[model samples]
Each structure stands twice: as structure tokens, then as C-alpha cells.
Target: MIRAALTSNVQVKVLPGPSAVTTALLLSGLPTDRFCFEGFPPRTKGARSNWFKDLATEERTIIFFEAPHRITESLEDAQTAFGSDRDAAVCREMSKHYEEVVRGSISELIDWAKSKDILGEITVVVEGFNPGTRQFSVEDLVKLVIKQEEAGESRKEAIAQVAKANKVSKRVVFDAMVAHKSGDKI
Candidate 1:
């Protein structure tokens, strides 16, 4: 669609404007060298959660677009996938008369969203994965699965949860579990 729009004979002069994502990125003072733009999140809860899980360990700053009606739910899902304390910025009505930018942890953003009537084009900028935190190994993943199972999750559900939380494949977690059970080094 963008290609077609630019190729049309109408002689279009494209000029840059203060989009919410760009403005938010500039305001956040995060590393600008490496960044990613994830246009719009999936509409469904399951799909969206899965997508967020996939991106949970992204090292580059991430940007996303959201509608007013779904912003609350999206924030909730983000809080689950990215954790409640992950840093994020919510930019609403960018460059408009009522432009607002709210920055804080995911949990704080969720609370703010709940207390207001959020109307406008919303853009969310989330801090990328920090590798300095505790890194999970295959053995760690196995232990996590075991803990989830002990906490009442089924074997399959535990594997899935561990895989998603570690940003790895379910097959990886399953293979790790099998290897651990067989007393083999993982």
C-alpha cells in the first residue's frame, strides 16, 4: 500500500511528522542505534500474549500501536509477558492539543490507564531485554518446569509456560525435561 501510494502519478511529497512512537523514543532517552517498530499488536488475547512472549527478550527497544478501547487489555497482557516492573512509555494523542505521555513500569501504566479516559492514537515504547539480569540455562528451564508442575500445572502446560517465559521453544523445554529425567547433562 505504501509503495502504491508513492508510485502514483499524483506527485506526493512525503514529510516527516511527530509520530507518537518517534516522539516517545526521543523523550525516553533510550539507545537509538538499535530499535524496532512492531506496528500493531495482535487483536486476540491468546495471539497477542503469544506475540508478547516471543518479544519478551528482544534486546532492541520496541514500539507498538494500540487503539483506545484495547489499550488497557494490551497493557495488562504486557504486564504479564514483560513483567510488572518493566519500563515503558505510553504516548497518547501525540502532537495534538491534548497530547499526553505517561512513563513508568508496566504495572504503573496499567493503573494510570484504568484511572483515565484514554482517547486518541496510543503508542507504547517498551524497554528491551536487559541481559545483565539472571540468565536461564537449560537446567534452569527444567527446574522451572518442574516447579510449575508442582504448583498444579500439567506437564504440557508447565513446559509451555517455561518455554514462553524463557523466550525459547516448547520443544527445547520438553527436550530439556526429558534429558533431565534421564540423568543426562543438558
Candidate 2:
């Protein structure tokens, strides 16, 4: 929003208005800090599936504006991409008299979406990826590094490869290696 700024075409002024994206986000009862708004999801099923797959690993809470007609489809794709247990909220008719919000796991939302015909503008908020839940033990990391090394990669290269593949830092992998050699717990 430009505040009293002049563009190449015309002058613009800022106006106070409630953001449906943020409004829906707040109503969803998810984390407000570090959220991202992704405008309308892809239309085609294949493309939407691919897009959601890529977004599945995002750490920041995600907000998406969607059409009522596509709500069920989007929820299905989301469940497939983010897994059935991911927390999410579907907000309908945001900032209006008939506003409604359904909060639950992705699978539960899918059931609710298919339960009845949906109406009005839709906003979907999904909790960020929880890395803690998908952690790899240091022993696991060391084994991965060893596997890569057995595949003809040097120790440095194997460490780097294992770190990148596991979405961990090189130092973490190095520590794991050291711990393995020292017979110390990670």
C-alpha cells in the first residue's frame, strides 16, 4: 500500500481497511507470528498438487485465499501434500455477518468441506512445517553419511550431501561423525 505516493500512472493514497487474509488468520487460532499470504492456489489439479508439495516444507505459517468452488479440491490436494495430520483452518465469508471458521487437522477439514455446500470467499490457514517432529537421530545421520561415502563420495562431500539431503547443517553432521568416533551420545 503506497502512502501518498505518486506512481508513473497516477497518485495513490492509503486507506484503512481490514485485511481479509490477516483477519482470517487471526480467527483461525494459529500462530500469528511469521505468517505468509499466498494469493489464490493453482487452478489445475496437477499444478496445485505440485505447488503444495513444494510448499509442504515451508516453516512459516501459510495463508491462502481460495474460491468456495475449489475449497474441497484444495483441501484434498493439501491433505495429500502436507499429510492428513497437519493443522489447518478454513475461514468462509470473512469479515461478514455469516463468517464461519472451521479449525482442525487437514483430514478433518476435508470431511467438513465435503459435508455441505460451501459459500462465500474462503481463506485457508495451515500451520508451518514442524521440523522437530521429523528429526533424524545423530546415529541415523552418521549412517546416512556413511552410506553416501560408500557410494564413492569423499568424507567432506558425503557430509555435505547428507546434510543437504536431511535439511541439516554441515556442523551437525560433523558433530555426529565425531560423536560416532568418540563413542559419545549425540
**Total clashing residue pairs per candidate?**
0, 0
lDDT value, candidate 2, whole model? 0.81
Give the alpha carbon lDDT tens digit for every residue of 143-177 in model 1: 77887888799999999998777767899889888
| Number of the predicted model whose lDDT against the real structure is largest | 2
Residues 103-157 of candidate 2 have per-residue lDDT tens digits of 7999999999999999998889999988766566778888878877887999999
Question: Per-residue error at 49 for model 2, in Å?
Answer: 0.5
Whole-model lDDT per candidate: 0.79, 0.81
**What's the true lDDT of residue 97 in model 1?**
71
Task: Give lDDT: candidate 2, residue 164.
Answer: 72
